[model samples]
Target: MSAVQTQPGGGETRYRIAVDTGGTFTDVVVGSSTGDMAVGKALTTYDRVFTGFEGAVRRAAQSVGWDGDEVLRNADVIVYGTTHATNAVLTGRVAKTALLVTDGFADTLLLREGGRRDAFDSKAAYPPPYIPRQLTFEITERLSAEGEVLTPLDEEQVRSVLRTFPDHGIEAIAVACLWSIINDVHESRIAELIEEVLPGVPYTLSNDANPTIREYRRASAASIDASLKPLMADHLGKLRGDLLQFGFDGDLLVVTSEGAVLDVVDVLDRPVLLLNSGPSMAPLVGAAAAPERETVVVCDMGGTTYDVSLVEKGVVRHTREAWLGEPFVGHLTGLSSVAVTSIGAGGGSIAWIDAGGLLRVGPQSARSTPGPAAYGLGGEEPTVTDACVVLGYLDAQGFEGGFTLDHDAAVKAIETRIAKPLGMDVLVAAQAILDVSGHQMATATRQAALEHGVDPRGALIVAGGGAGAMVAAIIGNILEADTVLIPATAGVLAAYGAHRAPIATEFLSPLHNDTRNFDSASAASAVKELGKKAKFFAARFETVNPDAQFSYFVDARYPGQAWDLRVYLDGAPDATGDAARQIEDAFHAEHDRRNGTHDPASRVEIITWGVRVEIPRHELLSDEVTVTGESVVHRHDPIVFGGESHVTPRYRGVTLSPGQHIAGPAIIDQPTTTIVIPPEWDADLDDRSNIYLNRKEA
Candidate 1:
């Protein structure tokens, strides 16, 4: 990683810090430019985000023999990945926002693409829009599809409508006039009026936010971007101020939904990009770990939810339909992001009996506040983490974050809440809780792979997060995967991934052209314009990283298709006959792989032109890890597996050297997490300290 600030001389070397804040814990990773680092974790303090952050950083610094505040002051840059913006949107805790669209489009949000999850189930209620209909005001203006003004801007009417916004306690505004992608004058003028009327009130123009062909999606993007302004602005401002108060003065970068870093100021303006930012980084690690693998499955298990993503053929897939809540009924983000499927089963997922007397793991969690009962934090519910503790998989002394696990509390919680009710043994009940959650993880991994037209069997599974290794081999066993690879930094992989993430941004231009009769000049000009924006953005982002890489993409589909597939071009196209064919071929191949079929003879309709600029990432240097002695089991404990108790040997993972292997019912506990080796598997440590668990021969 590059330095963001000048390094002060005298024994203080340039260092980079990456912090990932999840629902339960905050993980901090401090590394040198060569990527050797230490991970420290702590319970998340939601009330003060920096409190837990400082605690985690201090532990990491202490491990490296440095004072906490001194490390902060001497750091080069800190890349942070947080879930604050995502949580706020999902809980409706964001700023109050008003949506202003063109006349006759007041029902755009109310109708919400008019789709339902189950078409046969008419009893399901329609979900609420991002901005309530009552707050959606229609501006009396119109523009044709070709950028011609069908009706001139009603400036007085706009001013009158906005003047009353203050009374409604609106904190931000989103202006999404129809055809704004073609001509932005109407939306641009509204932005100016907003600045004049409400000087500090944040406003977003659809053209500047997401230049897409779909009016509804563009409007949705604008609505979300506007809604996040006040909340994210204050939240990010406080974070910066906290850093300054700690006497640390360096650049601060934040991860995006696209699995890259952005300037803090840029994130404040486009906070919508912060959604799913942490989960997106898991695929980055997977892709880099086994880039040549045809299909790589990455599962990041946190306290509240587990995210599953796939890296197919060395590329991390991105999707545009990232929903905030339910799939068909929830608000869409309308921006490009890494495709991640999340299941509500993790370390802290509460296990309960359903109405039918069936065991269910979770759609609800204990989060970090009271955490799992194993933490002795006053939580009475039996959670997945409690199961781990009750079964003796988690070691009290080896646990990270300087916390001790309570075996008695875990047993009591399960015995009262689950075992007694089910009339089962305490250990069996705990094992059942893990069985259910493991089923969910396996199901999600299978679905994620199958949905992408890839077979789950014979794939390489890369597990991450604090709780991921606990079930990595279990998922592989269920799916018949060939190998499960656990990186050395698996416990804090998301935070460590920040050290590898590139500084990147994307620009889009709406160009509705077809392959049959392509408008070469028009398409070329749009691509050229996108390139200009990329360069301008890079110029501003250069202070953080100077090197850059550019990639071109287009949204294209068969002529009769309702939706398009985003395809990347090998290089920026000149839009000649050959260039058109290249795009058409690329789209066809991707569409064929994703949809299982494509119409080669049909004309491909290209809707949007895009260019992504990113700082080229430097490959991490893998160091060989060797210990003075062979891997040794320090203790033995009764670990429950397959609903039965087995005395498993526990080994300290960090003390193991390369070429050392452990077989069968065994536990390898590291400072950050634990890995359980199943009865049929063997674990081997590689030179880079990555553990590979492989099943025995049939």
Candidate 2:
């Protein structure tokens, strides 16, 4: 396809566009300078990703009476978030990789930190490592923890080992020598030999990708990054080439797991940093949708997974210990990122009977291909969408994007897989599925909140994703939160968040120092070095926004502790008495808030220091639109609840005014999503078009 040219419009109108590619759908959102917003969605096409991306954007542009190419030509910035890296790692579609470790530590990747979720289950088998042990080669190099060389590098041995790569079909390589973070001389030399012998093969060094203290984690990060080199480099290169071909003259940015956007060149170097890129934006969108609420829980129930995150008092929760596939049981990125807890219980999650004849809602999903029996895509198994269809909660004819849902096929799948085996009617079985899935999500949400020491009861829960609005009320009621806020653009909320995300980059350095006699000169030098690196990275965003800001943080803990608490340090890391005192107070405050206790007399040790640089994001201001009349209900339908049917009034969401109120047992239908307010609940619309659901009082 070629770019379609149209008549030139005024050059003063600029647009901000963002596209988020999830496992099941690709959502596109556009924000015009005139305070107008539009969204478009299409099923995810894994084969040719840009096809779905362009299709979604074209649909959105058409709604605003503009050609897709014209919209790109008039855009100021375009940001994108995708699950490509995550999917590649999960499906084992990455390149054949080789690992080079110190002579005796070849099993570092195989023997991960040597822990499991269950300590007593010795019979349980270990999950496969990112790379097998047979693919690992030993290097004759070593360095002490204090950065002193223990054994000189064997240059001939390095050459000999790399010469065999062609026979082994190693497309990528990872180098992880002992104490490489302190002294990377040996690793650097090996890299030079690889470039000479294996000219085109891409490789990753642990010191460059992740300069942390842990050996296993750093090696894991390097392995994952190296394995993704060929896959991500090609994908991102093609995406950029396609965008330029389609007349997008503005800068193209990729969102990172840090809740900010980075240039494609920066992301290509370390694709592991984008593991949780898409889901990381949901919390930011939740905070922006309801700026009035300080604490908010974002529940995004997408087609494949239910992701939950938190923002306390406007600060998005960030963690350095984020795992990719499974927490503790899966591969760790070893990079700092926004903390999100995910469960495999979304609209497309499959429902099936176990060997013992027990009904179970998924940890398995149908994804987009043959998604759900209702999609008429030749799926024989029942999904959560089928349950919604059987219970009359969803209108098959009025489905999202004008796509028809096959109700008969949904009934057949449910009856065949779930109902008959459970000895129940179709409707009853569907409700049971909904109940089980909802409870699972609710429990996971509550645990995510409570584990962070935040009480979700008084917090506002913002719901997003395609199926987010459908279960917002029930999940909120289950958590007993004050209210739940569902944005009008719930279908593409992640893309909206990407649109508003700032251009940011982060730098981390290891600084092992004691707080009592902190070396002011050493700390100041480290800060200066980190600042220089951060400034260099932030230069990429200067074209979009010139004013860049930087913040400093220190990971500290009492002496003899295994873990450290991250404390925000104001200003630069000088050795002044005031700076030291401020850090001590901040550490104590954070410790108290997190663990409910603090010891001021204990000597603190600084483990690592970091710097964050960002260009302030554009504020998402709410526009006031005048409503001329009272809202009217256009239709009514009977919905089954609690084994009984109730006639529910259905209203178009766009026709509702700011002060409008809809009682329980009602449905609010929008173009892309539907909100179901069950019995004993009421819905209120705020001025910003945000819906709030609360329980009714007797």
Candidate 3:
């Protein structure tokens, strides 16, 4: 049941809601068109998704002193962000799909681009392909690199093979013909045949799914897209029906891996785009909160993992190499997505003693069902949260949902599971657990920074998530960063991020051109055609965001390079020799910036041209901060930090004023999360109501 508060409203209030369902919590943020926002969080209900979703929504409405029933009836738009597709792909719970490839390419998925995570570790286990060999069918077709059909497609053979799909229990089909990007006739014909032979079965075509130059990535994208069609179609359909049943009559948009929102109808056609849906929203918030022309490392510490991403000049970084699990050992999504590095070091990460009497923190999470031992939810294992309680960093009465933590249970779990095993004090063992996890979290943040060509020491730190503020200062200290920005809505930052993401989509077409032998007429034609498509794409969002904008980019590389780099063009290139030279120069600059080296004098090979169309969100107001200067202390709690116990002054979040200063050895207990100010760090609230943590004087 939703935690509803029966308050009378005018019954005409408009609402915009964003719901992000994570592994541990389902966060809901309700925003009015005027830019007022409120957040609510509840433990994720794996059994009934709507239970947690409605509960969070109700609580958020209550926080704003409004009626939830009225809010639901009048919601204008509801954006939903989910990790369902990501989890399904990683856990091998996707639909049973069949892959149909060109003749003599049955081992394409098996070989997996011929790369390993650790080239020196030959003993590592080899991962199986997405579709089994038995389910892979080879069609008699051939297309050369120049769009010429070397061998005509055997329609009879394709029809004969497709007729047997039912026997193999194939729920969906993926057709990836070799050189389909150069010539799509054969793949298009197969799509027609699939419709004729297996009427109701869903299918994906490489030419339609991803028209890239890479053979493996195109096929991988088609296969993954096809695998998700059946599962997501049913899931989304059910969700829409359930929403209608719950009295919601609004536009339903789902978050995409590309850090934008797509209408549910559009997502139903390309569900694979939802692979990194939930975490992608975090960078949107981080970028918006950060200052322009500056670099910031965004760290979102959730219940199960700590996620890190880099933002430069207010642009969230995007990558094409998103893996399902274990980096190179796992399958690739073969799509451009917001880049994030995640480590298993969150509040729910279990702490235990290894066989050698060494203390180790997770990698392993207790999840939301059992949660932490301190939650009093029948969890017996010691977790990072239990350790936090043992260290007095968390208050027993300050948790979400008006629930109190089990202090005795936290102490018992740590002592019985860790302290007794190592013959050490319970508090000491708890501190060790935190130290290990903090080191891992700090290392990941630094690695993400270095990978994105930003120095950790130079970039500002923006920490979020329910567990993020609890350890933000600790991470900042380890990196020795000057300051950390903790947004007042840090706990539900991703949900807030979903509001900032606009309706956007990308379109790409392939062309082979060289700087010396440039095809200006063909390049102009491709851009013109893509521009039309982008215009049509923008038309769909006219009702919500009419003033859409477009950007153009090119994929080019040094001659004979294995991979190409993307460079956004300031304007569309003309049919002149100078334009070709300019494109070459831009490619060189981008290559150097991303890869740290570029051969400016080398010949350039241009592969793909693309256009991005977006309807940017409306800007109305800044953060709705109403300062009272009435900072109230919850209590003076004795918290352990830096090998010493100190009675820290705990302040309430809502009662704090702008520019209010709180020194070290204090706690700022917000409604959703608690921030532990270590003895060496001092926190001050800015005019935007953001807490800026800086190091104390020497």
Candidate 4:
């Protein structure tokens, strides 16, 4: 790919485009130097996500009195982040992939961690293997943990597997040897043989993907990557091709799970990085966009899940380990935000009663299909969205500007499915469902905070999503957070995050030496080499900016420890006595923070060093706008729940300007979502159009 030349400033117009593909809708946001903004949303086409994205982009451009082609021509950068890869894996829509492992590891995927899938749940069943056992071929290869050859690799066995690929008719291949991270010779040879036999078939190696220890997680990670490769490649290719055809000359960047952007070209081999990209970027960008605060938590509630992440010191904290047991086959090598947890808490999560006469909200969601019963789309189940409608939390006539909603049907569904079963009124049932869901979300938020050793009292909750706004105040109350900031575009914060992200690339390499007597100079040199790789990747976005800079860090751990910790260095170490001590201090501090203590006497080891290259984006203005309208409270109606009914009033969020405040026992309605301000809590709109909710003093 050729790098587009940077255009000189004065008299030149620069445009940027960001597209976020969610489970229900494809949101498009376009910004230009002319100070014009265009936003559009279209129902997602799961079968063809690119079609929906392009449609939304065209519509957004048209709304701003510009043609899609013209908009593309003026755009200097285009950033896209989607949940397609994640959705594919979760729904089992990925391509059939074949796995090649060491002779005794054919059942590795099935025998994950002694067949114990969930440590917390005694009866939890193991998830079906991504590839069946029959397709998991084994080859004779032996390499010790230290990269020494314990047994000579059976080249004949690998050749046999390659020859049988045609018979298996595998769409993709994943090779994960026991100790590939230490020595990938056998895996590399197998890949070469496969390429010779199956010329065009895509193959992924465990070491090449993650290169971290742990055979099972590596295999799982690699398997996910190979399974989703074809699907992600097709969608990304179409998106790039369409943009180019539309006259776009800018580099296209995709968000990664670490809240950084990666070139579209690199996504083919590292598609696993795209998982959780949507939820990850929003919190990072939101924190950066907000004023420098001490502690902040971002709650992004969408159609299916409510994702919460913590941020401090203008950076979102990353998890050193993968959460969901190697969803892909590879050595895990990524910086993920720590404590980034999500629950089945969202607007469309289905609510129903179980066999034991108990009310349950979800792990199962209605998604966008029939959506909520209030959507007037033939859905009979009452969801959180439907509960909002029946409880007078949502405006029946003003929903989506009266686009389409069967409020009456929603009420009926709640009455028949939830209320009648428990001998309660419809309003009561809806309120119970809403309250239970809120409690679940609040518990999750508290748990995440506690797990990270963070005190909620000092945390500022940043809320987004249509559903996030409605529950922000309540969550703040539960967590004892004094402020909850809901930005103007709360419903589409993810899309906004994509728009604000800088073009970025991260390069990583393992550091296998012992830290006590290790060569600090050699390690510093290795880090500098990785920095150069990152710089080269960032140069591709020269059209956006020519003088883009980069940042660096290293993943380190105490010797003999299983997990490593990340430490940011001032610069590459010089391998001198002073540099070694500085590196050791950094690791000590990080270790102390994570484990609540540090062992200065123990030897430290550097596992991997990484460098992130990026071009910083223009900071956004945070000035507050004046409110021009009065806070109008609509009449309250009875909402039944927990075998009782109570009246609940609704208020308009857009109408309430800065300095305006509303007391609880009310609902705040916005186009994208509704906020349920329970009794005993109060909400205030900030100067920046953010809604701040606080608990009422006793």
Tell me the tens digit of each residue's lDDT in model 2 across 257-301. 999888787888888788888798887888777667668889998
What would the per-residue lDDT of candidate 4 be over residues 1-698, giving only the tens digit for each residue?
22222335556456778887776667777877655566666656776666777777776766546676666777877778788877677677887789999888887787665455355675766656667899898878789878898888888777777787777768898989988876788888888888887888888888776756556767877888888788888888887787777778887888778776777888877887887677876676568546588767788887778888888867777774545434333223243433477888888888889899999998687776767778776678888888877766667776542256678988888898899999997777887888888888988887877788877778888888657876677577667777777776676778877777766656667656566788766676776788677777767667667878766777788867866777887765665556667778888888887789998888778777777677767643234453437777766766442334558777766577777778766777665556666676777776666666677888
Question: Which pairs in model 2 have colliding backbones?
Answer: none
Residue-pair clashes per candidate:
0, 0, 0, 31
User: How far off is residue 186 in model 3, in Å?
Assistant: 1.4
Better of 3 and 4 by TM-score: 3
Please report, in order, the local distance difference test score of every candidate based on alpha carbons. Answer: 0.85, 0.83, 0.85, 0.73
What TM-score against the true fold does each predicted structure earn? Answer: 0.96, 0.95, 0.96, 0.88
Cα deviation at 522, candidate 2, in Å, is 1.7
**Which regions of candidate 1 are displaced past 4 Å?**
1-11, 120-125, 542-546, 617-622, 626-630
On the 0 to 100 scale, the lDDT of residue 386 in model 1 is 92
Quote model 4's TM-score: 0.88
Error of 1 at 388 (Å): 0.5
Q: Give RMSD to native, each candidate.
A: 2.7, 2.5, 2.4, 4.7
Candidate 4, residue 50: Cα displacement in angstroms equals 3.7
State the weakest 10-residue window (summed lDDT) of model 4. 325-334
